[model samples]
Target chain A: MPGTETAYQPTDRTVPTRSRERAAYDRELVHAILDAAYVCHLGFVRDGAPVVLPTLYGRVGERLYVHGSTGSRPLRMAGQADPGLPVCLTVTHVDGLVLARSAFHHSLNYRSVVVHGTAHQVTDADEKRTALDALVDHVVPGRSADSRPANGKELAATAVLRLDLAEVSAKLRTGGPNDEPEDLGLPHWTGVVPVRTAYGAPVPADDMDPSVPLPGYLAAL
Target chain B: MPGTETAYQPTDRTVPTRSRERAAYDRELVHAILDAAYVCHLGFVRDGAPVVLPTLYGRVGERLYVHGSTGSRPLRMAGQADPGLPVCLTVTHVDGLVLARSAFHHSLNYRSVVVHGTAHQVTDADEKRTALDALVDHVVPGRSADSRPANGKELAATAVLRLDLAEVSAKLRTGGPNDEPEDLGLPHWTGVVPVRTAYGAPVPADDMDPSVPLPGYLAAL
Candidate 1:
């Protein structure tokens, strides 16, 4: 089933066994989580074992393009005659450290989105170029227009795996620690320490002429 | 063979097919990358399909412990009457966004470690407790001693999987973007926009007593 208009229906694979309350299938939430993060952990099976690697990804509507080189095994697999490479792509943002009164209750405040689907190589030249632009813009929104697009040689050397954002779920844990009633009186301090990604001033290339000013979009970061 | 006195020998799975120059097997580098992060993407095979999930993990010397509930399928599989589960655990920290002259050359400055090995359920109660403490302290070192240790009931409720750090590699990208000679002359603003994890002031739990001050370890973060 395509699910309702607002949310994707949860499937067995997308539903977590524990902490079921934290999982959500709202399409907007999924997109928000995916769009906010540029790096993703991509998992694929090889030689009957799981391999997880961190890579850059870009989301265009319901599809995700993972940047990789053509020499990579997973990318080669997707380009092969095989149907497609089944993968699990996950992105997470740790919001805070949940320090509870008891060690058992200690946890992290995080928002994570997991997508289960098959990834295929983007063989279409136009789609591949679009995906590359999306990947660049993902790192810094509107960056593709500021930089030179991939040339023919560069495009042919690169590999892009497009994974549709179907069978997706987002899990979140926020607020403060949930210590037990008995442990509340303990001497230990309980609270949440907020965590975030901070960006420092951009450094200009040593060889660049001073006249080339920072882009307005990157300056905003 | 154990490659050297201070580095783990490279296994087939630990080597990167591409960007081979960025891969390192130095034990110290691997430990540093693993210790600095609390969350990891744990990958395992489920029904012959790869599944990756974001979870908290702790490192004790050469052993890495992943926190999970007994109800989870991977944990259950590790506890079942069978060989250890083949898993790949990865931790990544995006240091900065490398804005290159060309979109094709754009990349991220990141440090990551990938461990591919078998994970066994920590059946020993002592090790499990130690792992739990390590997991807590990994979030904020020395905070484990400041908080109440898990009770017997809590210990029994949690499930842990221990993976030895035998096959491992640390991949890193630092410095600025490496744009091509021809593209360097372009007007594009090129350089690395540094990124880092920043921690804000800790917020006390609503129910906590005002007298209990923040611990020194957490305050340092």
Candidate 2:
């Protein structure tokens, strides 16, 4: 199953060699973590300093896409250079809190994916529409078809950037904390404190045209 | 209540003047968003490239604290220079999924704080303990006191970085999507899809010493 491509030495960015086992080099694991996250932190350096922005993102097969206004600085910068903008995109989902017997061993149960790549701005007219659709669909599955497509002016003003799924890694921590054997006898309550995310009932806008019914995809979500 | 000391300026690093109004400068609003968040994205440039990492963080007064092992690159870098490491710290809470009448207007309802500063490593023994306590209390209140304090060896191995909350901004988008007046008459369902976070029942470890009872503070959390 892991014989799809030749393996390369994946650089350890966050966790070093001592914590290497927590890092997963599998593509499926990385993709799953990215797909499940609602938002992503896009990092880019502007004027020799680092800036991180939390934004919505979408994944299409082996490529990830992000969109912003054409006037946006980062979007414009990505299209300027030959290699585009060298960026690191990260998505994380906190699964649970690992409470260990020893304070030093306490940790969190989380699934995260980090992508290191040079993003190129999407310029083609048809491809822009396709990318926008993918972005909309990723946020709300069937709602893209029910809503009006972007007009020519709107499309022209928008900027879409695509980053390939290369140089990526997934790190996951699940189950409870691995407290030391000696600490197991310490009089401290220890376990996994669960964390969860939920969606509330959709509230229709007051100005909504009463004729239109809620879409099935939104209701399902 | 807008005191002179609480005022924040829009620097070149700040999201331009137009985007600045949408960016809140209020301290209370900033603290509310920060305290409610468990994780923050730390962004820094490495070798002319942007790198973003998601990690646990805590806020105490006007200072934000992030900790890591002394061997970590970022931590080591932060400890080197006198002025410290230039970093951008951001914390965001997703409140709702905004569904607009038109697909172009689709966005998220969120509250986020972005702090632009140079992080200084905490070296003093007393300050380190206080910062560590704040970190633990930020996650689980009172748990810091209940657990064993870090020993000299553990303290020496850990690195705590602090960023003052001076050049900070909090941006929030609440309510439903701001669809255009003309689009409001369109036959499309539009509104907000709320998002929520909840805590689940605690799962005690099998090897946990039964003598220690669940602390009231943790139980309340």
Candidate 3:
């Protein structure tokens, strides 16, 4: 465990072999990165091979929840009586394209969090409801309250997996390219092209009433 | 094999358990999806557990190249004698937010490509050079020619792994939210919020000549 409450302890698996300076164990940074993304790449072993799938996820405190139909492979695997399915969930945001004068120095400015742990199915009724709401609200803040909650039948069909954020690390690269001193004078434009997620105007459903006003939470996006 | 050259034959793993309608084996669609993203979540088995990592990748024809320092674990694993390292490379682009009347129906409009294959280290110098050039060009079209090629020392330090895109599938969700007929009358806003990747103005390195005009390709972004 970490000596401080605000950070997570570095584990053998979480410590990167190279560029150790890029890794962070700050708890808040991990939560912020996880909450900002709408989807996460969840990886698990199947038949002795690795399988990675993009899925919706929600972070409630230090616990991360991912849901799918009960028949889904990962969820079903997590439901097994075994301690849980070992999974590595990762979230990444590309902030910029780092172009260097030397081809060897080219890299991307990105922030990514990697979680290594076992994922168990959420069995309690109330906890599953909280996860379901978090899943909906994670997409659009205050969405669960605005939309109708899942009915009993819908709840039964869904399987929620919970992974505690005990072993995690965020790796990031920022600023411009790191070109060598000799290559600085090369005749190539060297810089960063900033990349961001942009949200466009919302289009109402055709079946809905045109008078229905846009909610404040969505407009805030 | 696919009945025609225009598509990929979906294997058991490429075929999704649910939402089969969203799966596409079209070759061009798969390439377009792969070309649009800068980062991919790469999964490989590590120490008998699943490990997922976000890394930069370049797609050339039917092959995907991922590079890192020769000391990296995955690269070292791929360099081993037996066959190659089994990997699952997935790229996802969240196109829009699907807001439905019922929580159960909420989803994200996304385009994703999943490639299931074995990765082998590129030991041939010529192939490695081509893969490195492709990686640089993938960041910004027409960039490799403008930049200085990697030197002998740099080329020897970096390692590139090649994975052919023979087993691939593209899954996409588009348009607005799909609300149930009965729930359409709920007192909530229903619509689709478009999400896109926006590129910002390029920022040159502090040491770069201020007079260097921005390249046409970057300005076009």
For each candidate, what is chain B's TM-score?
Answer: 0.97, 0.92, 0.97
Model 2 CA lDDT for position A198 = 77
Worst-scoring 10-residue span by lDDT in model 3 chain B:
B1-10
* Number of the predicted model whose DockQ against the real structure is largest: 1
Candidate 1 matches the true fold with a TM-score of 0.98
Residues B1-221, candidate 1: write the lDDT tens digits: 44346999888888888889999999999999999999999999999899999998999888999977788888998888378899999999999899888888888999999999999989899999889989988989998999898888888888999999999999999988888888878998988899999999999999989999778898799
TM-score of chain A, model number 3: 0.97
Candidate 2 per-residue lDDT, tens place, B61-98, comes to 88899999898777988988768989999898988989
Question: Can you tell me which runs of candidate 2 are displaced by over 4 Å?
Answer: A1-9, A12-18, B1-4
Clashes per candidate, residues 3 or more apart or on different chains: 0, 0, 0
- Which regions of candidate 3 deviate over 4 angstroms? A1-4, B1-4
Q: Candidate 1's residue-wise lDDT over A1-221, tens digit each?
A: 44345887789999989899999999999989888889999999999999999999998888999978899988997888378999999999999999899998888899999999999988899999889989888889999999888888888899999998889999999999998888888999999999999999999878887899989998788
lDDT of 3 by residue, A16-52 (tens): 9889999999988888888888699999988888899
lDDT score of residue B68 within candidate 2: 90
On lDDT, the candidate that comes out on top is: 3
How accurate locally, in lDDT, is each candidate?
0.90, 0.82, 0.91
User: Each model's TM-score?
Assistant: 0.98, 0.93, 0.98
